[model samples]
Target: MIYLDNAATSFPKPPEVLEAVSAALSAPASPGRSGHAASLAAARSIHRARKNLARLFGLPDNSRLVFTANITWGLNTALEGLGLQPGDHVISSAMEHNAVARPLNRLAAERGLVWETAPADGHGFSSPDDFKKLLRPETRLVVLNHASNVSGSLAPAREIKAAVGEIPMLLDAAQTAGALDLSDAGDWLDMLAFTGHKGLLGPTGTGGLWVRPGLALRPLAVGGTGSASESIRSPDFLPDALEPGTANTHGLAGLAAGVEALLKKGVDQIRAQEMKLTGIFLDGLSQIPGLTVWGPRDTNSRVATVSVTLKGYSSSELSAALEREAGVLTRAGLHCAPLAHRHLGSFQGGGSTRFSLGPYNREEDLNSALSALDRLARLKA
Candidate 1:
């Protein structure tokens, strides 16, 4: 199958990543557990991985980056650990995934913490100016999506920071972490969440959150940090403060190798190639009749993900037909982003067929998909 479902999880791991994981599993030990050779080796791997992540995102302090099971857990840790009082408000974009929306909604329902969203345009873009109007003194945090998972439109994080001046922001860098350059994120963001499975080219069950200096969050879970074991409460430091139980050192080993390779290859180079491919695909898509391509029409404002709706078919049917007839793999349905779909006018059509590009995709893959879409669009009802 021509794998185009990379937004969910990248397939065919890099050789270095695979090698590192294999090496760890072969001679494994719990990280931060003991002083033996195996334990020390695990600790070394996790430490290196944290440093690599810090370098990737321009983080000054590597220890501030804490690992979680996935981006959801990282987000929850950030949200729940904030210890917000009643009537505290959060400002987020309409393009956010349920990862942010669900937790905030639950907070509203349970804690009386109301939240508001910055609306997006038809192209899936939420302007920083529009975001500015929604800001209030009661706003405890500003949540930003670095890029949309559906239309792939990029958010103006730094611009929003200018509008938000001094208010803490949490960036959801799920789609842009390893796919794009963010060397200056540390300058603006107080905290952010990232997943290794998508753009980072690492294994599932690997992701983390990064907190800037001078920010202290109440520990969501407080027990067994390996350090300060003598004390009843969790340590007042990072990594150990947020992380509980045994670490996923084997996955972290893969993540370290993945980010290292990404660094060597260069983020700009990957982005340039993806934009060229997206241009080619978008040009071809424009020729097809009865098809609506959503998101920014130009490459300047988006990633490689493209969402499309056919005139006479549901997204599920089109995806099923494409897979059966063309051997292409694409994601269909709501993509766990129902509010985003509603904003983009795709919710009524049962979501959309999403074609998310990865570094491994080539020109021929897009051509093949476009040809298949052209043929499929012409079929009789």
Candidate 2:
């Protein structure tokens, strides 16, 4: 099958990632569960993965990285842990996925915390200046996306950081973690949540959060952290403070391999290839009559994700037709970002069909997708 849903979960993980997962299951159980040779081996694997990811993001201390089940878990952990009391203000962008929106909405009720979202522009981009205008002195936290999942619109995170001036920033790097260069995050970002299954090219059920130094978060859930066993209370150290219960060592093993492979290939190289594909795809889509491509029409300031709608086909209809007729798999509907869809003016009629690209995608894949879309558009006409 031609997979175009990398924005949701990447397909056909790297061979090294597959081998690592199998190797972990055969070697040992979860790390820190015991000091046995098998367990120590597992712990070492986890450390290696952490170190690789830390180095990728330019983080100094790998220990500050905490693993979670997914980006949603990491986002929730960071959002809820902020300990916002009544009347505290939080700022975010309308392009945020529900992962960021839901937690803040709940906090608005639970702690009387108020939140203001800067609306994205016509191109589905949230400008740094828009956020600057909304920032209040009481704004306790700034939640922003590294890129929009719906349109792949890259956010000006660093520019926003420069404008915020020390207000703690929580970044949702779900779309840009491995797809874009984030080595600069170490200095400006207070925290970042990433999904391993997406751009990281790892299996699902594995993700993480990176918190900068001097920022403390209240633990969401407390239990056995496999450390400080003598005390009944949970340890308030780096990862031990956040990680509870047995870790997903098997998934993490694959994650390490994936990150290692990405580091070797170089994010710049991957991005260049994706940009070439994106430009070709966008140009092809624009030529088709009765079809309107969404988001930034050009390849600049965006990832390889492309969204579009046909005159007669709803997003779901087009996706179903593409999969059934042409074997082109895509994601349709709101993509869990209603505000973003509304901003793009695609919400009223459902949402846009999204074609997300990854390292595995090729020029042939884009050609096939465009040919299929042309046929579909002709049918609609």
Candidate 3:
């Protein structure tokens, strides 16, 4: 099948990534657990992955990087470990996924911390000006997604940084990590939550959070960190403070290879290819009657993800038809950001059908998808 649901997880990872993971799993010992050769090797692999991530994100200190199961866990580590107390305010955008919104909402409801959502424009893009106007003096943290998972709308990170003026911004890079330029964001962002399976082309359950220096967060879990064995509490350090148990060394090994492949291929080239494919799909979809494409009409302001709805059918129907009848796989429903759907007016009925492109997508795949969509539209009409 032609997979267009890359926003969930990328398929067809590089062969090297698979090899790395298999080799790591075949190794004898776990990383950071023992002083044996196998353990040392595993530790070295993990260290290499950390360094690669730091280099990719333009982080000065590799030690500040901590691995998590995925972007959700990374965001959890950043939000929960920050020790947000009662009465403190947190600001976020209306375009946030459940990963960011659910936890914050729970915190606000239980702890009495004030939660404010910055309004976005009609296209689900938030303005830095509107974000600035909503900031209260008690606002302790600002969490925003780098790009909308539903609409692929890009956020104004620099402008938001300038507006907040050092109020600890945590940028969720789940949708933009390997697809867009993110090295410059590290300088302005206090923490960044990233996933490995999407644009990074790594195996599932691999992700991390890069923390800036001079920021201390409480530990989410306290256990044996291969350090402070004599003490009962977790080690008060950058990685160990957050990474509680044994690390995902196998996943990280594969992640390192994936990251290396991305660097080798060049992000700009990959982005250009994705953009070309998305443009082709967009143009083709626009020609079909009863198809309404969402997000920025111009390709410059969005990622390769596009959401659409048919005039007479639900998104699920279109997605199923594409998958079953046309051999094209696409995602249907809210795409995990229901507020984003509400903003786009897609929540009242069914959510938009999303087609997210990856680096490996080719012109032929675009043509096939477009042809399938055209046939589906004709049938509906």
Candidate 4:
């Protein structure tokens, strides 16, 4: 089967990732929970994973990295931890996933925050000026989706950060963490949230958040961090303070291996391959009649995700037909980004069929998908 749903989660995780998870399971050790050798080994594994991810993102201090269940958890932690008072404002892009939107909505309802949306253009592209215009004296923080999961529009992170100076920008790098080169992120981004299951090619239940030094955020939940058992109060530190529970050691082992694979392979190489596949798919899509593509049609301005709508066809119908007729897997509907779909004019039509590529996708896969789409397009004609 041709898997084109990398935007949701990646498939065919690296061999090392599978082996790492298996090894962690075989050992049956809980990190920082015991004093035995196995426990020490588990703790070491977790530390290595944190270090590798910090290096991957070019973060100077590895201790600032905190593990979480996923990007949603990280986003929530960052948003809620801000301690925004009444009349404070938070600005985010219009092309945000439910992760950021829902959390911001909750904060607005509970904390009386004035939530603002920075507008993107018709192509889902937003400039620094868009955010600059929305900046208010009461603005406490700026949250940005580094790239749109629906439209695949890459945000100008550096520019936006510069425009909203010292506003504590929180970057949701869900789509670009492992797919793009972010070695310079430490210099620009104040906080970053990432998921390992997508472009990192890791198992589910593995993700993290990183905060810049001197940025104080309240812990979302206070529980046992396997540290400071003597005191009833939670520890006031980097990771241990934020993390509260038995860690996802199994998934983190796989995540560490996945990041190792990317470090060895280099994200630039993976991005180049995905871009080639995207260009080919876009070229093929243009040849088909009655097809309208969304987002940036070019490869340079977007990730490998491509969204499109066909005349006289619902997105659900097209997705089902693709799977039934050609074994081509694709995701349909709003992709949990109703705000994005609404902004891009795809909400009323039940969203659009999304075709997202990964490093594992081949030229033949794109060819087969294009051929299948051409045939499906002719069905209504």
Query: Ten residues in a row with the worst lDDT in model 4?
Result: 118-127
Per-residue CA lDDT of model 3 for 164-219, tens digit only, reads 98799999999999998787766788999999999998999999898898788787
lDDT at residue 157 of model 3 (Cα atoms): 77
Q: Is candidate 1 or candidate 2 better by TM-score?
A: 2
> Of models 3 and 4, which has the larger lDDT?
4
lDDT order, best first, reads 4, 2, 1, 3
The number of the candidate with the highest lDDT is 4
Runs of candidate 1 with Cα error greater than 4 angstroms are none
Please write out the lDDT profile of model 2 over residues 236-257, one tens digit for every residue.
9989999988889989999999
lDDT of each: 0.88, 0.89, 0.88, 0.92
Error of 3 at 182 (Å): 1.1
Instruction: Tell me how many residue pairs clash in candidate 4.
Output: 0
